[model samples]
Target chain A: MSFFKVEHLTMKFGGLMAVSDLSLTAKEGDLIGLIGPNGAGKTTVFNMITGRLLPTEGKIYFRGKDITGTQSHIINAGGIARTFQNIRLFNDLTVLENVMIGYHGRLRSSFWEAIFRLPRYKSEEKKMRSMAGELLAEVQLDNVADEKAGTLAYGQQRKLEIARALATNPRLLLLDEPVAGMNPRETGDMMDFINSIREAYGLAIILIEHDMRFVMGLCEHLIVLDHGVTIATGLPVEIQNNPQVIEAYLGEPEGA
Target chain B: MSERHRREWIYKLCTYGAIVGLFAFFLQVQNQADEYQIRILNVSAVFVTLAVSYNLINGVAGQFSLGPNAFMAVGAYTTALLTLSPAEKELSFIIEPIIWPLSVLHLPFLPSLLIGGAFAALLGFIMAFPVFRVRGDYLAIVTLGFGEVIRVVANNVQSITNGPLGLKGLSEYTNLWWSWGVAVFTVFCVTRLVKSSFGRAMQAIREDEVAAAAMGINVFRHKMLAFVVHAFFAGMAGGLMAHLITTISPTLFSFFLTFNLLVIIVIGGLGSMTGSIIAAIIITHAGEWLRAVEEPMAIGPFNIPGIPGMRMVVFSIMLILVMIFARQGLMGRREFSWKWFCGFLKIGKRRG
Candidate 1:
């Protein structure tokens, strides 16, 4: 059995299928790329995997345990954290505060302990704050730690979202369009940051990226989906040459 | 924390010390000006309690409750029914049956007051339990309905509340002591609660309910916890009100009274307990001070007519202006913290 596996996942919004009978297996420490053109249902797969949406018909197994229709918080607590395609961060909160909030679920301090100013609660809060700062610094966002998240530039906001998800201490992290609106320079910088965080944190990552070069460079394995159906799943080279995958992307436009 | 923030902290400390000192001065009966002076102090203390408790629900917990007076009524009736003597109660025809069974409740004044408070708090918890599942405007409407339902029951249940005629002639045990003590205790509890992890959870819910829940904060549990705690203090304040006036009527505890408490908190600051405390003192004393201006005025060598209800008109305008300019209340969302200042100076607890 794979570390994470999805079988026969089908989700329908009315008569239109958002995801259709998709099945895949992700082994431990796999850096997988999920790619397709616009409306390829890449994010829908991430949502289903993260338990943000339930499969109309399917089973999801994480580390050999079936996890279907679980709450997002619980799934996150169970070692899966995800960012949205649009960067859904708590924008009003300060950058550091946003990251600290991500650790709120994991902090182990009793209510009475905090009220009484127990040494343990005091030290734990301090440690968590320091850890949040470290995470922000990892993404080179330390300078804007005190600023409201909404005040950050677009690229910085994307980095902060990734840092916040990392604060949850997940075994599996999903990045939806991690570099959607970045210049080539920022795109390269973000690609580097993602690879470094994965190696340092020892966490498996599933990424959605439209930039073919960036995705191909980082992903050890690849899956191609078009119109809510998986057309190819193999090594990067195998996926790049698959005629069915070619037709799906080719069907939408012309040539190649 | 900026230099301005440091100075503001020192100013706040001095103001608190002065306020406590002033109250201590009032406690000395020898310093009393007259019957009216003592009465004003008593009213200030009650307002302080109500305003602080209101902050617990509205500011720290972020529940927009408009039901303070209803809880107050519950406390007043409970205290009256528990402590009044049978013969004395019969003279009033108000709450004879309830007190007739509680001869043991005649054990001193303070204990009876506490028993009444406990019952009122229990009633508050019962009322808040079901409504905690919802949020925002829906919860507000449910609580408003709860307040009305309590009032209707008080009106029609002649055997209990005396049916709009109201229970009266109970013992007048409130003075500078019970009122001021509860006021001080309310400030203490509210301050402590806001500093707790539970308080942090509540504020998180206020900041962003979805993120707070994703952080496993148990949003509904904390909301209910705050609601019950707020009800407990509101009920206690109500009991004090009944004793201060030495009379009771359903008309006294109405939605209008809730609106007045709302004004008190709004004028101070929403989330700041200190703001609420300061605002309470101002509103209470200011109402008394208004009478002198509103009453008949005699100028030197001339007579001037005083306009009644003019003060309320002025107060309404002041509320509107405050909302426009200082909408976060007097304190914004931050509590008064000396340590945060030290952190900013790079000398104390490290801040992110």
Candidate 2:
């Protein structure tokens, strides 16, 4: 059975349709990619799935339960995490604390318990710190954990964002433009890290990327959108050869 | 030992030892200091607590709330009624409450402060339900309206607040130990909060609220907690102030009080708790020192006559200068850590 399902999802912003009648599924261990040209509403789809934006007409089922219209907190608690297209992080905080925010939702301490520094709360806080440290190590960002998150290079900030998402212990992770501003070498390293994380954690991922090269190799399933409409859906190989996908990408490149 | 382990241990030792030393020092000064200086120190400490708490909400969490005066008024009135003298209790009946009194509660200083803080926090939480609905200029206006409404209500309630006369002749026993103890506690609490995951979430909301919520920060709830916590401190400050002045008046907790606190935090730094405290101390000391300058300047062989309002005029000029030259106030949203302190001694810092 699919770990998460999005059926007939539609989102409208005032008079404009942001996500029009889209349906998709992410099963256990599935790696899906949702791609479109700029302004094709790709980020809106991620927003809807992560409960940042509610779909006007749709059902989202996570683990066989209806999660449609659920709040972002509940959705996160249900094992969904996302990174932003523009690398949104707590800039003033240290890198380690940014990842710690992701671990807060699953924290078992009551507010008073944390305040009083109960034995359990103290243990949990220590655990969370090391877990955040491990996640930083996983993303190969252990060196910059003490620096302000905003002071890091753009590529490192992107890695920090993904590390924060992973800290949520998510079953289904959504990454938006994960390698948008990276060098070719850094991009290659990010790809390897993402792929290894998927295998190690058994995570299903929905990737939204502008880079065709990485998305094609990373994603097993590709869903293409054009101006809020899903114009094409298939495996990456089929998508690369589809006429509509080419047209949506403003006609195929001459060499490709 | 791990580096973080050593750092954590040192932090704990300093904070705990500092807290105890602070109370001890204040207790020693209980009889030595003049009453007026003691009173002013007490007042400054109260504002110190208020400013730090306000920093938690506006500076750390990025919610601009101008309702500290309102919360303070609530606390003052609550304490006034709870700890009123027999004559004051008789007057309290003339000004009836929204609800019937269980009995004439004559509480001591600490219990009264706690109850007042809790009561003020309740009002703050209620106010936050709507205050946080808006941001920026709109939030400022709404919170200002809350403060005004509170003053208006207190003014209209003749039986309770004594109308324009206010509550007179309170026991007035607030001391340096109590005031600074709360101030130290406030700073400790906010500092610890900023160091924790919850504090990170608050700064996240301040930095990018939408992303914070997506990351499971619960922006609204966090904002409310910060607001209530700030209001709680403001109420404690109010209880201290009410006792210091011994006479409670609606005019006592006015927009003036709000602006003074705002000026302290703003001049300090928008998001710096440490800056807020340092700024509060400077402002308080400046107010005290300005008295020395209120008299006309006496240069060599020239007798400068005292100008009654010259102190205020000179203080205003200093405020403008601070704004223009050092817009970030003293600390500029940065905490004073051992590294920052030791950074002054560059070689020492590098060695350890």
Candidate 3:
């Protein structure tokens, strides 16, 4: 069975269809790239998969269980985690604290236990703290663990967002424009980091990126979309030479 | 037990010890201080509880609720209905006959306070659904509307609440010990709550609700929890204030009362518990001190005629000045700690 699947997913804003009949699938350890031009509804697809938007039509199944229209947090609890296209760190919190919030889904201590500082709360908190610390270390953000998240540099903020996402212990990780704002060197570093974490965590990943060359290099399977419709889906090499994909990117040979 | 558990136990012991010490000190003040000073102190304690609880919702959870006064009304009425004697209830309900069940029952102070807080929390839980649907200024309007609704209900419930004439000649069971003890307990609970992961979740919600939800924090549940917890304390504080004054009416739980709490939290840093504690005490005392400005005064031989509502003007000016200069209020987001205190005093090397 596929590790994750979105079948005929559709989203509508009034008369406008934001995402139309988008079907995709990924297996264990598969690296899928969702690429398109600006306003291609790539983010709309990510939002539907993460339960931020209820699909107007279609099913989103994780491990063969239908998770359509589930609450975002519940969807996250079901072994899926995601980063925002624009960085969404808890800016007022310390870097470590930002990561610790992602561990919230797994913590078992009740609110009363937390209020009373019960033994269970204490032990669980200690476990989460060290785990968050280790995750930060993995992303090379341990040095700024106590610094406010807003104060971190752009690249460091992206790294912290990933570390925080990893703390959820997800089976499927979604990256929405992971290298949105970065220099070429930083982009290269982020690509390597993404590959390493995928290998280390042994999970499926679906990334949305506009940088065609970068997405082509990182993703094993490519899914191309333009105007809320999938134009093509296949291996990176197959997608590179597809006539429809070329026409979608560069307006139909100008005089066909 | 593990070493961590042992340390925590020790910490609990020290906290209780400090509370006991405070209780003893307040008891001393009750005996030695004049009636006016003692009343001021009691009022300060009640306000402290109100301000800190308000921050839990408005500041920490970032809900911007303006219906705390309604919760306070629920609590005040609940406590009054519970603690009033049958004869007192009958006498107070001359405009209409005393309501059944409520008129027949009388509870002691502690239980009455508990039931009052519980009732307020229940109201908060009920309101959470519609209230949480909106955000920003819309939330404020909805909550304000809720407060006005409660006040209107209180005005019409003559058989139960004695109507606009209000309840009077009640027992003054709220002394320094009761008021200040609850204040200490409230501070302890709030401090512990904000320090825990639950508190962190509330802060995360405050920073950004969408991001918090994405991170698997149940946004609605957490918001409701903070609202209910804060309402419970606000209700308890209202109960204390009602008993201390020996009276309550629909007018007592007005928007002005909620505004007073808003001022307290604004003067204290929004997300800082310690700041609320200090700001509550200062603002409560300042309100009383400013009363002198409202009364005519004689300096030496010449007499100065006082402006009746001058205190409010001065307060408004002060609030505006604070907003312009030190907008984060007293503490910003920083908390007070013994270690920080020692460092400020230059008594020891700084520690993280």
Candidate 4:
């Protein structure tokens, strides 16, 4: 049995088939990449996996549990976490508060205990604060932990988004175009950061990226999609040389 | 204890001390002030309760809901029906006989208030399902329509609401103590809730619902929590307002009431609890103080005739000026924390 698997996942919007019969599996610490052209339904795949959209037909099994079509928060609580292509930090909240929100699902104390400031709530709150502080420190954002998240630099904001996703303590992490808008140096740094966290957290990562260099250099395995169909899947070197993958990207050499 | 811990302890002590001082002041005012002054204070305290709870949904949770007036009506009517004596119900319901369960079900003021609030919360819970299906301007319109629907029902339901004549001449149970005590409690609960993890989740939803859900924060549940809590407190405030004025009709909880609360929250700073409290007090008093503009005045040699409703015109202009100059309202989403207070006094490091 696979550690994580999506079997025959299909998503349809009215008559438009966004993703059809997409199936993949990952081991406990596998690093996989989903590469496609713009509008090839990459985000739709993430949305389906994260429960933002219900798949038309599919089975999602995570750690021997069929988590098909569950609510997004419940899916997240069951150990799947994702980041968006667009950074969606709680911009008005402080950096620390944004991370602390990631731990909200695992909160042991009820709201009544929080309202009354009971001993349990106090202890839990203290623990949450410390954990949030550690996450900020790990992300090199501890110096600005008290500052509003909106004021951070773009690279820092991206890091903060990843930090927040990690705060959910997920075994599976999905990255939607993790380095979408970045200079080469920043992209390299992000690749290194993703690698470090993948090893440190022992996570199975499935990332979507348009950046070919980042995807080929970092991902051990790759899947190429074209028009909602997986055209090729193999080791990174094999995928790069595959004729079908080339046809999908370069488009049939004009006359052929 | 460490320096930070000691400072926190002192802060807690000072907060309790201030609360005691405030209650003592309320006692003094109740004993010495005239009925009119006491009435104004009660009105302000009730506004505080309404504004703070209203902020939980509008400011904190960032949902555009306009049905608080309807919830208030539900609360006020529930309390009025529950607390009115059976003999009094007989006298008040001249058009149609009072309803069976309500006519015979007379209770003390406290329980009646609690039941009223609970009833309003139940209505809020029911409304959340349909209301949250829409967002932004659509949400405002839907909630506004909800308020009208409740008002229309109250107007037509003679057996339950005494039609448009409304309940009148009830016992004056909302004194300074009851009104201010509830106001203080509302502020305390809302502030504590906002500072909790649940509050962070709500704010995260306010920031971005998609991201909040992906982070394992239940968006709908937090929204429902905020809505129900808001409804509960607004209902309690309605109950207090009902007893303070000793009368309530369907007209009492109209679009105008909701509009007034919107003005209070906007002028107070959308997400600031302290801002809501200050704005409520200021707006409540300003409504009375600005009435002088409506009265005829002899300035130098010119004598102007008094114009009814002129107070509202001046109030609207003042609101316009505030919007133009201070767009984020008075506090601009910043709370009044102990550290900020000490910093303002130049006795500690500035922090918020």
Estimate every model's Cα lDDT from 0 to 1.
Answer: 0.80, 0.84, 0.90, 0.93
User: Looking at model 4 chain A, which ten-residue stretch has the lowest summed lDDT?
Assistant: A247-256
| Candidate 3 lDDT over residue span A124-157, tens digit each | 9999999998888888889999999999999999
Candidate 4: regions farther than 4 A off: B347-352
Regions of model 2 farther than 4 Å from truth: A251-256, B2-24, B91-103, B296-316, B338-352
Winning model by TM-score: 4
**Chain B, candidate 1: TM-score:** 0.84
Task: Say which prediction, candidate 1 or candidate 3, comes out ahead on DockQ.
Answer: 3
Window of ten residues with lowest summed lDDT in model 2 chain B: B95-104
Candidate 4's displacement at residue B162, Å, is 1.2
lDDT (Cα, 0-100) at B23 in candidate 4:
92
- lDDT at residue B147 of model 4 (Cα atoms): 98
TM-score of each: 0.81, 0.92, 0.96, 0.97
Q: Is candidate 3 or candidate 4 better by TM-score?
A: 4
lDDT tens per residue, model 4, A16-118 = 9889899999999999999988878889999988998989999999999998889999999999999989899999999999999999999989889999999
Best by lDDT: 4
Interface RMSD of each: 2.9, 1.7, 0.7, 0.5
User: Measured by C-alpha RMSD in angstroms, how accurate is candidate 4?
Assistant: 2.1
Q: Write the per-residue lDDT of candidate 2 for residues A38-94, one digit (tens) a residue.
A: 888899888887777878998889999898877887788788899998888888888
Better of 2 and 4 by TM-score: 4
lDDT at A173 for candidate 1?
Answer: 88
Best candidate per DockQ, number? 4
Using lDDT, rank the candidates from best to worst.
4, 3, 2, 1
